[model samples]
Target: MAGIAILLDLWRKNQSFNAGLYSARTYQSTQFFSASAAATAATFAAGSSFASRALFGSQVAYSDAGAALPEDYISNIQSASERVFKNHALQYSTKQYDVQLKPLFSAFELRTFALTSLRSFLMYYLPLLEPRVNMEDDDDSLEDNQEDRHVDLVVPFKKSVIQIIRESTVVTTRRILERIAVHYVSQRMAWKILKDVPQSAARKAGRQMPTLVYIYCVSRTTFRGHMLGVAASWIVQVGIDLYRFFTSGFKTLQEDDDEKQVGVLAQRVSVAAVRCISSLIFASIGAGIGATLIRPSRGQWIGCAVGDLAGPVIVAVIADKYFHVTL
Candidate 1:
């Protein structure tokens, strides 16, 4: 009976320990669930408060005066954009006129002045110098004397001829520049005229003969005027050189020793020459087509303008493909 009592007591102690452990685990689980529920409730309350504030703020904003007239606001923005575009177009047109047409015109004027001065100098000196003549003595006894005299005359005559050529080159170059400038200016004006007039009216007008005539006349007149100037400048330069050569006793002076500054003068002359010749050739072909066929009607003008702008690009392609030229 004593052994059984002892065994029973041990079993009761084990059962109590197991019950205590289960109770402790149940309490921990319940505490964890309560804390999670409280956290969930707090989160829900915060979310609801945020939603209410956002809804109220939206209502208040809509009720304000600034929130209305969305279409008017969009239309105003569109109208402002259109105005800006129009302003930009006008400014672009003006810039094109100034940059494209004005510089060419100025160059033409300068070329004319230089050519005129050259021609005047030439006319003044040619007759006085009698540059084309070869004087020979008829004294048969002095054969060596006759030969020396002929040589002397030939040298001066040769110099005179060279002077004449140089003068002519300047004149020709000036004429070309002037012609190009005139054509460019007229075309620019034509563009403005078309833009100013109503599109329908301009189309109905078809060919503008008066405008064409104006362009031609201006080109011709400017060319003639500039050519005269170039001729004069050439003659003048020649005269100065001749004067210096004669004064120096027919002795050939070193180019560096000369006060006439031939190198700088030559460079200027070359620039004028290139500008005139290139302008003439380009204008005769390029500008001629642009003004004649392109300027007659609006459609023609548009086509011509596109072609004109694209001309350099076309030439570049040709040069690259055929001539192996590159930039």
Candidate 2:
């Protein structure tokens, strides 16, 4: 019943978001037409002697005002075009920054890294992560210490099974939620970028319905290079992590903090490197699997997207079980 209710709620939210998007598009169309009409009128009045005189007292007065007719018309169009282009360029830059960050998509990215890095080294091994919120430090500590979160059973075997199921469900749901949010925000950012004026970061990044990314990865080849790229990226990230693990300065953990918080340049670089590498590997794997199942290009794209998202979590889990070392 709970799952059904959540599904129904998500469906409703999706419909609402689609409707809002349609309305926004309609509004922008209206604005564009109006602006076009106004520009046309201004240009006509400025260039034609009769229109200029009729509109602004007299041709003599217009010329006295020092407004060159052709220059004004040309400059107006140029300015409008430049404004539109500049706004779009800014949004493009933001998107590029986002791609560099990888699995740390939006707000959850950093916290995800921190949790994965911290928990991997702890003596008491907890594989699942709790969601971060803006609560007090003491509240966070209390929550962290409660190891039986989401699953509690007396028998070790039964408890482990239940825990794994519960954790997997939670992890999967969170990933979906984050992906949905990122997808929508990205669409909104695209629209915001194309405007004559710049949009606020909050306006572009805030709550929105899930929408497709207007842009996508360019996978032009069916060669095995995609998979090779994935492996290469992972290897590079592992190398960087090892380098950072050895060179980065030690930072003391906060009194209430559950994990060691390192603040060295090497650590930051390694985290970013690892994220990018994982993203590439997953994308390649996804593309290959998808191609086998469907159209090569479409399948590749779908696979790549899924891989990019799931890759980080997979890496984190592998590290937790095998490496069992802290950064």
Candidate 3:
């Protein structure tokens, strides 16, 4: 019985040992599987993150590549190009006017010549009508009395006329030239501003609208239609001068002079008429040249019209106030 009991104890011990071993093996397997699963999950997460980063990088690159050019930059480049073109056009136009138009217009030299001739005629003829002073007046008392009397001597009309012509021509020419120079500079500036605006904006504004905008911009600035105004003023002045000179000469011939010689008054009137007419014609020519050369936008035209109308008046005011010119 003791031996059997000892054998039973041994068997129980073996079975207990085996059961503990099986439990430990199952636990180890579970642990191994859990570790593997965790590792796989971690790897997947890492891969996902890497993929996300790569995608983000690609997206950023695409966006950068697709970015549009700056509008202002484009506008600047286009404006620069247009300015270059306009400058060349202006240069060519100037050359054409100087070489071609000036020569053709020279036939109108009569316009100025008539004025000068009339002045010369009046200066030579009018003095005859003045009362002659007797060098033989004998009495000392009478001489002394006459010397004290301020004689209202009539100016020979011819001499007066000539003087008027010379003065008017000088004054008118100076004003016309100044106007031309100012207009040219102003137009150039306006063109630069107009060209500098973006092509996209211009296109969006459409044909008539853009032109109007350009005109408006130029007019508001010092550059609007200034050239045309300058030119027109010159033309008008010249035309009026020529008309007066010729008309005065014809009228002088028709006048009845009681002395049978051209009176001082008649001569003076002729000279004055000639001078006035010549100045007017020269002014007109200058204006015509400006109009031919300056091609402003429609808006510019409106601005030019306003400037043209105002230019002479302003010049006159300046001359009267500062230069002491007879307006």
Candidate 4:
């Protein structure tokens, strides 16, 4: 019985020792789990703080870029616009002042003056040089009549030649003056007023503009461009008319009797005035029409000249037909 009791006590003590070892292991496991959890929480908090700082810095950079981008774009546009306007202004100024003129006494002009003088001389002098027959010197009365008639005709022929040459000179002078005025006085303003007829016509045609509109535009442009030319022509024509009137008046006063001279001077003056006005009007109209039709520099010149020549004839025809008067 004592041996059996000793064995039971040993069993109890072994069981208690096993229970204490289990309790210690449980406490150690719990402590390790708690420390691991605390470390994970601290790591998570640090990562969150870093992420927030990075996000905030990115937002600040984006906002700065957003604000700066529009300002930069606007500045670029403004600079580009300024450059374009400056270039346009420079080009306009250059084009405005660009003008070229021929020398005053150019070869073509000299030739023209020479030809005009020669033509005038020939027209006046050729009729006087009739194939003369060697007649007997004893025909005194016949010779005297021939001399009187020759004297009367020669003076007029000489004066007519002089008048033509003078007119030609005046025209040549006027052209030079006009060029000078266009270059120095009016400058680019005149060029703007003057149309480039062929180019303008072509542009208008491309746009399908009407013929009447083209004609009107071209005519108006021609008139504006040749205003000085027209004025010069009028002055010259009026001067010529005055000269002829005075010479004719003097001749009439000498030849015609007192009764016939009463209203003849006044009538001649009126005729001269009518002729001058008719010439100016018709000339302007002709130049316009010619420029419209021809569309070239030479065309305008030819038209003006033809108009000047035909003005008197047209006036005479109209007067003779409608008014029963000869100009």
Winning candidate number (TM-score)? 4
The model with the greatest lDDT is 4
lDDT value for candidate 1? 0.45
lDDT of 3: 0.44
Q: Please, what is the whole-model Cα lDDT of each candidate in the order they appear?
A: 0.45, 0.46, 0.44, 0.58
Report how far off residue 87 is in candidate 3 (Å). 22
Clashes of 4: 0
**Candidate 2 Cα misplacement greater than 4 A, ranges:** 1-263
The digit string of per-residue lDDT tens for model 2 on 1-327 reads: 223323433553465555556654444443344344334444444555664455555323433342334555556655666676677788788433232212423223557545643443341234334454535568767777575355532344455554444333344443444455455656554333222111121122233412221112122131222433344444444555555545532333344332333334456656656776677666655655664455545555566678877977888788778998332
Model 3 lowest lDDT segment of ten: 95-104
Q: For candidate 4, lDDT tens digit of each residue in 155-250?
A: 757767776666675666666765767767667665644445445444544565566765565555555555555556556655666676666667
Tens digit of per-residue lDDT, candidate 3, span 33-106:
33333333333334444455365554333323323334564455556656766766887874212211122223
C-alpha RMSD by candidate, in order = 26.6, 25.7, 28.1, 27.0
Query: What does the lDDT read for residue 53 in candidate 3?
Result: 39
Task: Give TM per candidate.
Answer: 0.26, 0.24, 0.22, 0.49
Candidate 4 lDDT for residue 281 = 61
What ranking of all candidate models by TM-score puts the best one first? 4, 1, 2, 3
Model 4 misplaced regions, further than 4 Å: 1-94, 99-109, 125-160, 172-185, 189-210, 237-277, 291-301, 320-326
